[model samples]
Target chain A: MDPLFEKGMTELNRPPTDRPFQAFEIVFWHVLDEMFEERLLPGDVLYETALSQELGLSRTPVREALSRLVAEGLLENPAGTRGYRVPDLSADDLQQVFQAREILESSAAALAAEHARKGDIGELEEIHRREILFSSQENRREYCRANVEFHFAVMRIGGNRYLERAFRPVFWRSQLYVNYLAEFHPLNGEELTAESGHNSPAEHAALIRAIARRAPKAAAKAAAEHLRSTTAYRILLDTERARHIFGGSSR
Target chain B: MDPLFEKGMTELNRPPTDRPFQAFEIVFWHVLDEMFEERLLPGDVLYETALSQELGLSRTPVREALSRLVAEGLLENPAGTRGYRVPDLSADDLQQVFQAREILESSAAALAAEHARKGDIGELEEIHRREILFSSQENRREYCRANVEFHFAVMRIGGNRYLERAFRPVFWRSQLYVNYLAEFHPLNGEELTAESGHNSPAEHAALIRAIARRAPKAAAKAAAEHLRSTTAYRILLDTERARHIFGGSSR
Candidate 1:
């Protein structure tokens, strides 16, 4: 059994106040965690039987989870193949992903500005604080998680369940791009300054301030600018580097 | 077997160049068609065993189709219940749906303005022509179908697969709102005039012209204005009427 799978299973087995987690959901989050943590790199193929055996479960739940991930655009089942692989997104795919993030997240941020309660602002500030802490400590993994949480917190504060739901899969796909960026361009502790242009904490703080001030247009602009800066097209323009980061060749 | 399911099965059995439709997919579309046609009203509960028996298939595919619809927000599985019910959307849900539609469809229209080829415009004009023909003939069903095709065509021309895919389920949920509007407020031939404010044809034409002129912002504004006119909050504000249309009571 894979050590990660065992660790996930132990976590899943812990009792919760709500209903128990389903088998496939456990598998789904486990796989997603692996991808985010870079244990499962782009282009790595996952066989249903191998995963089922590794997790000491039947193939049905594993297959279900794999199909769900594929449906969410996190994984792709190549034509005429049974195995699901982490998608090697092309430059165009990254462009579309970022464009979508800008549209959806900006709208959410604007709505959050309108609807955000004091508690909501507080929650956002807490996440932003963690983001800064993680960045200062150069804890890339935790910083990435906190960054993703900050965006989702904005979406939730928007008070539109439909928009929030639509944002989920797109956000996950963008995380793949984030992971690649972090891998190719590791940020040193000193490079976390706003002048470095990779300073997510400063950008996030601006978004938080806009929402807290109830400035819808400013909030929307800040969100869009943040995404545009983070997903700098110049990085994606290097076909060779993108190919290397996306695993030697585009699928 | 139900005649609708039989008709859908016949269509599924037809020869195609690419591939045969799966059983679950056939069920999915069949159910969606029934909903659009108002043959299956909101608040109706669908039982897997009953649907399988009606379609003369096993429970597996029916279950899969129902679950897919639930995940798509077209149907909801009530807590502690085995059946899936067509959602009886609240006024708030309608508001959120329209807001999302504005955000997504306007983005799509803007992108279409930038990316549309001559052939793409021609295709949209063709669909618009059908819409006008149907509206003039008072063929509400066909007009509705053509209307949906027009929006989807705009999305396709946007050249963003991610946006297009994300638009699907939200688009479907919004269709429920469209159906209810059509049911409650039948349009007379005279009412189809632009002065009557039920003039979808005119609004659609304005959107087409904007896209044809390659004016991205104009295209976006036209699309947003069209949705705003069609989903007038005055209509949704009548909670009692909305409840009656969604089926006697709110879910």
Candidate 2:
């Protein structure tokens, strides 16, 4: 049985958005949103027929959406099956992802510092402002969206198109996994609750200031630290989850 | 007409390898080998029927091989055509590729330093020795094959599957372009002819020593320097090529 359409999940039945997107685009974002919200956990099958019927659309769009998601690495087709499911990555896999991100994003930030024009800096500032704005809202999804935009703005400002393109899929897939983790196990729950929207903006401000000063090394360090801190929180969350599962004897 | 099959290329008509392999594998490697040797330059067309007929095989295997190459970013289907062509990337695009490679490969070397066992170091040494041996040989293709093996051994020793997977396509595509460039313009013609394979092995040895000592920072630094030096040579070659093309007025 599909976990998404399983019993007691009545809230997800809302009609697909009537926005001016093509049907495939609509379905793609809907599935992605569900994955972000952890409504679709690892092993939750995305059956095209079920999704199309639930969303009041034909199967073609849903199928195309699944294919795109699979290509994006957010979902995978199980062996001998047509349906897609959230990919299951091991701890080593997750660590490699973070390690790669640290290398790429830090370089990107440094390059951004070296190359960012006034317009680029201004754009990043605007994105950070929106990120801060969304963080205070009750909608976590909106905050996530703004966060993605902010980081991508930095990547674009870095002025390395190949780096940006290569980084995009990894960043998105990592976020999908990280967001799913954060759903139940808040990484640093107390700090998250206490700071709410404050710390991220402050961090972004520091990064922006470094870039504004054209201090390449400092900007790279700042970006790397930002990502490292996030990963640190994730590690803490993983530890906490394991402790719970093992009756506090693990670790 | 397929550039590979056109005029004066009688050497390619030799029977596909006698080694026990399927048809598709032979076609794939043949195309890849041609790309590595710069026999298929940028803008060279790869007509499926032509390649299939020339190789004395059906089009299905050739088509699959082309698709894989396209996925690997070696070939692209030109607009309004069924044939593929070597992609034409700008100077900026090539620079970005090298930048991304520097980030990924350097970090990979660092990780390998941290995690490489004695056995891993031994394997790398063996691969490096093979590279040295091939360097003395007149066959540039054999030297390249050994070079690829040596680098991939380091990636494997790094013990990061995600990084290795992400690095593979980028590395291959960059090699394709670099090899093409080197055909007409040796990156460092004088030094290359003077030292031949001697200098590269020494560089590899230094990297191996760092990893053997478990000096992650030193290993990463060495790896990055190696790539940076290679890129420096490439820049020189590009400048020389430009000077010739523009009657020495472009600079």
Docking quality (DockQ) for each candidate: 0.53, 0.27
Q: Can you tell me which runs of candidate 2 are displaced by over 4 Å?
A: A1-34, A45-72, A75-85, A186-198, A235-251, B1-34, B45-72, B75-85, B186-198, B235-238, B243-251
Model 1 chain B lDDT-worst window of ten: B188-197
- Tens digits of per-residue lDDT for model 2 on A104-182? 7888899999999999988988878877787767446556556667777788889886677567667766675465444
Q: What is the C-alpha RMSD of each candidate to the true structure, in Å?
A: 4.6, 7.9
- Model 2, B143-250: lDDT tens digits are 555666777778889887667756776777777656544444444465443123346677788899999999999998888777756633355446656343221111
lDDT per residue (tens digit) for residues A1-251 in model 1? 23543432123223233665567766887887777666777778899999998878898778677777776778888555678988875678888988998999999999999999999999999988988888888776567667767888899899988888788888778776666555554231333222123388899999999999999999999999888777434456555656555443222
lDDT of 1 by residue, B1-251 (tens): 24554432123222243555567766887888777667777678889999898888888778767766776778888555778887775678888888898999999999999999999989998988988898788775567667777888899899987888788878778776666665554241323221124377789899999999999999999999888777434456556666555444232
Model 2: DockQ vs. true structure: 0.27
Best by TM-score: 1
